[model samples]
Target: MVIAVVADIVGSRKLDDRTSAQRILDETIARVEADLPLAQQPLTPTVGDEQQGVYRALDDALVSLLMIQLRLPDGIAFRFGIGIGAVSAVESVHGELADGPGWYAARAAIDTVHAKEGRAVPGARTWIVGAPGQDEVMPSTIAASNAYLLVRDELVGAMSERERRLTYGRLIGRSQQELAADEGISQPSVSKSLRSAGSAALLDGVAALRGDSA
Candidate 1:
């Protein structure tokens, strides 16, 4: 089984320069994939505002998606829905099309995010769902993942643009001195921002997801 992802810009119509935003989104996706190298299919723009991709594991999806969230510039944000199941490709006149339970679960997961955003957790940007008829164990995994995602989205949504950048730099093994140099700030300031913005905790969480030691 593969992990399928569906993503769309958070506020596409409100952007003053949609073309520039799309360019940044594309570039950021490329950069993250180059760094992480986990996606079975790198995220690519699909229809209208949505993008699609697949990963071999749930941890890979979580890591790459979080990096995308952090790497994006200030004005652009994406909401993601991840699905766990099987995918089949159908030959089509327009090339090949992704069909099956995996894509359907991804669609349902995104719809869940949309509904949650409108009700209480407006910061909710990601959700996960498993295909129907999965083994009993899968539901528990999905529940745990959704719990983690809720907190992850809230913390990321609250971070300043600079905080996000700093977090992303740290994730890719960039030193504080290097990040400070790039940001035109001091190393101490970079440290302060990471601590104050809860980036340290977020990074720890990411490490745990990746099966790395704390």
Candidate 2:
């Protein structure tokens, strides 16, 4: 089956510069495996705040995103992007990972998400290289697109424009210092805004939008 791949960070630069980000990443991976075992997927942790994984079905993938949004701890949030395509091999040799048009498509999706402007939220953006028979086989893609629309609105309602811009800056690989410079503010001011804006409430709003109890 053609599947969608998602990569994300549980906390952006808001995490301490030290080892806490890695611990958070590990915790995020464990949560994914525990919460959605049926997806039967593996996630590769990249850098301190990022992780990559694949899903065999769009519904499972979207559900996983929702779960991540709902479960993140206070002072932590996530920004993610997804790609959809077909792969010849679901699981490959230990050292030789899956790499093909599907993998490339997935990377493209991540790139698209990374290119987005402000904080990354569910359905911030996605890339899809239609696999053979993909249009006919994956009706859920349409549903997922609709779901993303809802997610976007929910995120916007939960966060202000300033918050979104800061989040977007981080997603595009801008460091906290860089974002501060770009906004003509000190790094501490940026940090203060993010904390004062209430990350937990934003996440709760996201969960509510997904029809989950916050």
Candidate 3:
């Protein structure tokens, strides 16, 4: 089964510059895909502030979405819902429309994220759901992934922008010295920032997703 991802801007109606925010989103997706190249169909604007994409695997979606989160600038953010199942396209007057249980599950997942934010977990940004009756995913796996995402989203939401940039740099294999030079700080300071901000743990998570030995 393929993984379908649905994402929409966070607080889009309140943004001062919607056009610029869209541009940043587009550019960020381009950069992350260039570095990671995971999406089977790279995220493309669907309508309004929403975007959609497909991935061949769940790990790819998690890793790419996490990179996008870290790469985005302040004042702009996205929430993602990933659904696993079958997807199809049906011809429509306007164009070929995506229609299937995969998209339906994705919509449900995004709704879950929205509902979650109003509750105790305000930092919630990503979630996953498996289409009912789909043999591709098990309920236990989805539950565990959601548990991981809850904590992951909280840690990422708490990071300062600088910490995010450094984390992204490390994810893409930039050395601490290189990151420090870019930020105009000492290498030791860069290392400290990464450690203190929990970038190492995030990096380790991504590495684990990639099946790299710890």
At residue 197, candidate 1 shows an lDDT of 92
- Candidate 1 — worst ten consecutive residues by lDDT sum? 205-214
lDDT of 3 by residue, 165-197 (tens): 999999999999999999999999998989899
Where in model 1 is the C-alpha error above 4 Å? Answer: none
> Candidate 2's residue-wise lDDT over 82-193, tens digit each?
5566665556565445655656666665665555534554435444444445566465755566455455536544665566556544433357798799889999988876
lDDT of 2: 0.56
lDDT of 1: 0.94
Q: Model 3 Cα RMSD, Å?
A: 1.0
Residue 210 alpha-carbon offset, candidate 2, angstroms: 12
- Report the lDDT of model 3 for residue 135: 61
Model 3 bad stretches (over 4 Å): none
On TM-score, who's better, 1 or 2? 1
TM-score of each: 0.98, 0.55, 0.98
Stretches of candidate 2 exceeding 4 Å from the true structure: 10-14, 46-49, 88-94, 118-133, 137-153, 156-214
User: Residue 56 in candidate 2 has what lDDT?
Assistant: 72
